[model samples]
Target chain A: MTIHQTPSRLVTIADVAREAGVGESTVSRVLRGQGSFSKRAGERVLEAADRLGYVPNRLAGSLAGNADSAGSQLVGVVIPSLTNIVFPDLLRGLTGALDGAGFQSVVGVSDYDPDREEALVAGLLSWRPAALVLTGLEHTELTVTRLRAAGIRIVEMIDTDGPGLDIAVGFSNRAVGHASARHLIGRGYRRIAYVGHDLGRDLRAAKRLAGFEAALAESGLALHARELVGDRSSAASGRAALEALMARVPDTDAVYFSNDDMALGGYFACLGRGWAVPERLALFGCHALDITEAMPQPLSTMRTPRLAIGRAAAEALSAGSPPGTIDLGFELSEGATA
Target chain B: MTIHQTPSRLVTIADVAREAGVGESTVSRVLRGQGSFSKRAGERVLEAADRLGYVPNRLAGSLAGNADSAGSQLVGVVIPSLTNIVFPDLLRGLTGALDGAGFQSVVGVSDYDPDREEALVAGLLSWRPAALVLTGLEHTELTVTRLRAAGIRIVEMIDTDGPGLDIAVGFSNRAVGHASARHLIGRGYRRIAYVGHDLGRDLRAAKRLAGFEAALAESGLALHARELVGDRSSAASGRAALEALMARVPDTDAVYFSNDDMALGGYFACLGRGWAVPERLALFGCHALDITEAMPQPLSTMRTPRLAIGRAAAEALSAGSPPGTIDLGFELSEGATA
Candidate 1:
């Protein structure tokens, strides 16, 4: 087991300098190719460095090692949360392409906070990754500056409505919301309510709500009630929010959840309270998650192409394609719920 | 318009060397705090380096960084999949406790492969993470050696039967499997079949299957048929596996799935086929996921204390406690399924 293993200590400029019998500064200058040095001296230093197995530590300079490394190959992707199956499914597609091309991936989570996202972006950028793949375009001003200035490729995924930084790979949240509202309105459900998490922070959700309300307005009807929860969206929060929404607005005929997970929770709440779904309270949701389809009567939801989006983003990066938006499209599933 | 600007050209190590009127190697030595250097020289080098805002490139000599940063109130956790929701729920508790104690976390995904996990651990070790919090302890020999020589702390999660590398935090997988089998057997369900994915790779699932088979043997009932899929346990895979299993073994009265995701899939399959669950054929699964309980007929399964396990592991690391095992018990939910 005890093979002749080298000490694992880094071969620094000092080692090269010592071996070459020259000033350490000389080695640094020669390595950087900045200052003038005698060719013989440079040759001696290089030979000594090669013999000592000296590898330059690029960490000393932020940009020294990152640029021109086979292409913009290492992409730093920042998502809101991995707990959501959609994100991972997206990654599965993204990695399938990125891996084959020898591109490495570094990931960061913002926990759905714009401020945390900005900080995470800063940390990720320190690596000088080839490209930045962020969840949504709604980032802090500081994040925008750093990302723009970094001058690497930028791709904002999962939502495309407003102006993009460089590239956008997703459908319009506003369009999705409008479609959901139109679909519900067309079904003769007048007294409609909206149950969602913090939309102010999640601009994508806000856009969807705007589109939904716009469709409702066109139909000469307004939202019966809207309940917005603070912080991350989840089943428990969805259930609690729905309970509060229904309790406060008893006359609402239909409820549209922000996402399927929340709607699933709302469904459970209905089951717990001994209320018949669809007949008593029609429920609609987005993201046709497997469980949503698998539930006893199935859940009526809009299926977003999450994995396709991810795969497309990776493909764009791979091909070094010009920055633009791509709409993968969505589908509305009419299940037993609505 | 430039309230703050990041220049196109970064401040590199050579700038610090020239500013300090010292060799570049002297600046590196001071920043790294490695190899003997005069204190006066180091102070000058460090002062110049600080002014220049140099963050070292970790890619070069990353291993040394791991060796230096070990046991510094930072834990690196590598899990297989966050989509499982089990891992995130687990991380929620672990981070909650550790965050309070001034400990930070860095995470990596191994994608349920021993080889990927080995690379991730090596990467994490280079950062000198305080404690290595991994999903399971079934590691490659090289991974074991690197971990053993890591000289910090270790915590293996989610199963306890295997040999603990350092500290193990989980319940016995075998017990859960046996209990599930016994519960089904007690219900007079013979001609039972098991359906799961990648038992050969998923050590935990394999252990459960072994235990389930043992219990079946004790009750004079063996698996009527077993089907294994080659992938991580997923809803779609589970449903497909179940359909295949059912088609082959039409005489089977009950089926056991690897986890709730796959079980939900199987349940969905039953729904699609118009087979009355628990009447025409019983169903059983593990990990009492919240969605599973929301179904009309609650999932009859065991709720592993994933969060509790994570919390206990973090607590052990923060308290600087010695290596040992922590068993957070599992809850068996007796529903109409089996």
Candidate 2:
């Protein structure tokens, strides 16, 4: 009934050779599917390998200078949470682009924890991937050190506000925040408030908020109220935060959310409470998700080039491009909500 | 401004030893952080390794029988697509469970293409992972052959209508369809239509549709009308398909969508058209996504144990349990939408 017994000892090519009644050289050629071998010998070798569960050592093959093999075909990618649709969109673009170039991605999710990211980096690096693609510019000191030591192509994607360790492809978060604030202010929304998830871990959100506050200050105004949820951003949290914010600051006219998921929740809160959007309250969000666009009243948000950034990251790695920032700018949609 | 010239030659331990002015064994000891080495020797080795970009070959390490290292700690996963929230939810559960057991997931997205899945399987096997986790029970012949030959723990997740290659963890998709039909029928609704995406590639969705049709036939009724989109399921597609269905079959009293994404779109379409839900026309969907639950009127749908399936799959692999199907079961929610 045992599904699989963890092999007590690793299966070897020699074992397959012995079982197939072939020489080790013939067994190796057949298993690797390289060089010439008789059709009968190939069948016997495969059957023996299958029976013994002898997995071919691709690492050994790579070490033998097989440039087109497993090691060179892998690109290790590390990202934050998958709950946010943005990360998945990024992955779609990356995988789509990487697939075309005959490479596969090995992914790790860090859940916004620096220590987890550092460990994941070490683990992926040990595989000797052709390149490493990371979510953002920030990382633990150890992560930075290890990436530097790995000597692989390093691509820090979805942020370009600072210097990258290697290649950086994304729009500036500060600029996105600044534009959101300006759009709201241009429409004469003075009593603007904020609803966001924990900013301590999501540094990008923090950066965006900073830009928003700076723009507001430039206009001689400040946030009337704010609700900072201690958990990750979600529609449920956004709904609760909006309800709480409304109770504390009833006169707040406009609300800027950290991202579209939060804004969708805020929109739902207004719908449930019978608050007229843009008339009684205005809402703004970042990362123009498809759901947001399809809302009864499309959410007013900045459409960051998420998929494009992912594609660019992959393309840069495949082409072996120079290391620098590629700023694919954002677009502001003045949706009916705001 | 060359960021990195794809290392013309891989730096080896001997190279590090030469640069560090130390023995290769000492460099290896320092790099692996095993055995004993003087502090000065360790420092020199690290500096040299960093300067030379000497990546450790974990494949060789595993071949050398480092049981706790890379090969054993990896579990390769292949899923259909990431665009669906369901897949991400499954991954969240998987990574959350596997992380605790000191295992990391290497993921591949097959886009519901059996050929792509086959290639992905071969690619992942080269890494010599401890286990292989695949979605659904269906696979190409070569994929099945390779998985069986790989001799690793295999966990087929999120569908359990058929036999698994090894461990299977999920509810029956057919059962979900049947229950959904029964629920709608119990509500005394008839003249139901269906809106779905391409079923040719999504075998599980096809299974559910088959069950739904069977249940309908048992009740002496069949789909009053149906709309099958050639593209993948999405809210936008759902919305568009709903409009098309209503236009084509105005008398249809209820609609069953493939999944929550499509249903959400239908909901938005209804709102846009001022149609009262469940009164004018009822709606139902599969996979109870959070967005569906958080809607103004929650969606009536079947909630498959997606996360539980993922957790169970990981647990089975880690625990090395018996080879059998584990029906985690599903839940049906009759919300206001229906």
Candidate 3:
């Protein structure tokens, strides 16, 4: 296909040097605008390069050890999913931080698949990024092997529960779940139910559920019922799942959702059924999204340091700090929902 | 800084060839897994390369005219913002399409700044991507010059109100606004106001507003009031903007928002104030988001072909189609809100 067609013979620095009647080093300095060179030589080189349609190959320059080149200004970021607002918030924080530091993020979405992540890792590594930032600590064996071999800084963001390959920046999902469960229990939500999306792909969500169940055991109370939607988390799926759960277990006192998207749906379901929140049913969620906060009765949820985690990850990479975990922690919002 | 430190003496293919006791061509074929080579020779090359920690330089391979290499499997995508779900939805569709074709998307967010977009275009182009996908048709002169000089396929997505650079895949924002205004007018609402975010940066929103105003002129009626939030569009901003607009002009019978995010915020504001929707103040928005639909009264808005635009953009690039526009038209969802 033409998509794979090699670009028509690109104009190189040598060609520019010849056309400008200058040395190759002069042409290089003029194009990079780095090392000092004669102004007249620079003008001629630029003119020649522009005339020949020469676009500098930063990839080759990076390989040639141009430390201050634009090639080294890129940070490869691999995230799980973009449909969820949490991931986008993470990206916003990251790009914001990176922008001020003159670093650009080249992002890849793996859709929560380890195989795809491995392939993406291999593909991004081929670009020779200055650093690589991954969503979670968990990765395939091959992905880890490639990263180790690549010899670049690796920052794992959004979860700090497990040991990281290089650097980890985030709060504990397990802790957020534990705190959320404790808050519900303290409010006398004994027959609480749980509604979530597929926990198989989302390990962080699975960890939160584990901690939630553990907290329930501590209170000698367990979920009265649970509904797991087979699809990705969304308001529509959350509404349907909550409906299915309430149909089977009508006495559920409270419902805990995987995240704000699902929780918003569950809240909508309750609103549609004329169920009084916190009296007929209490609904809670993770990630204190703005939309959730703007709800008529704000949702009771845990506010994970999403933006902070992203900023911290970029800062850690830029700072070249020692490899370790940086737990920014989370906060519990006691809204009117619970 | 150590961040730019050249990786310590990377092992080259020549080293692997010497260690594996094979020719350089044999080592290359083994590493690429293309062309013919003995199985034993392949195993030896792989073992030697792995032991020496050799990662193939696809960038060099690309320059060397390897058409089927991973270097050519990259498609650079530059979006405006990720905080808005619209951008992420576009990415979701793009990655989904690119993934099946064994291509990975390297994304850059411009934060709605033309200067940032120009820099991002230069940065991404340095990687020699097979195709470059941009958000809108508008670009700085330098950005246009670079794209023209790059000699690669360029796909401009999301708005088709003007001329495209190479390929355009989206619907007319002006048409969407005209239809939306007509819909509200047909519903017997005249005292309509508009609430939006910084239209200076979001040109598509500006086009919609222009079209909305044009349609109103045809009906010999203009906006009763308008609230333009100086910040980016969000649910919180939408809520505050609506509150401010309603306070300034209480007689406003209907309000149109930039998108569902802002409209959802206005919906919440109405709920908080106990304003009966469609009876006291009707609300309409764009991008019929799922959360908007789950509200007590589904939001009456236009459903722009967001995901389809992303898919079509990728398809156009992959199919190596000729330079033109592919307008995947939008839909008008007549939810109960308006």
True contacts kept of each: 0.17, 0.46, 0.54
Write the residue-wise lDDT of candidate 3 on A1-338 in tens digits: 12423345556789888999999999988877889998898899999988776777665666676433223566888999988899999988998898777676777888899998998898777766789999988999889877876778899999988999889999899998999999999999999999999999999999999899999999998878999999998998899999999999999999999989899999889888989998999999999998898888999999988999889988997888899999999998889999
| TM-score, prediction 1 | 0.75
Residue A107, model 3: lDDT of 79
Per-model DockQ: 0.20, 0.36, 0.44
Q: Choose 1 or 2, whichever is better by lDDT.
A: 2
Winner on DockQ between 2 and 3 is 3
- Could you say which candidate leads in DockQ? 3
Q: Candidate 2, TM-score vs. the true structure? A: 0.86
lDDT for model 3, please.
0.87
Ranking by DockQ: 3, 2, 1
Q: Single out the weakest 10-residue window by summed lDDT for candidate 1 chain B.
A: B55-64
lDDT of each: 0.78, 0.87, 0.87
In model 2, what lDDT does residue B311 have? Answer: 93
Best by TM-score: 3
Ten-residue segment with the worst summed lDDT in candidate 2 chain A? Answer: A63-72
Model 1 chain A poorest 10 in a row by lDDT: A62-71
Candidate achieving higher DockQ, 1 or 3: 3
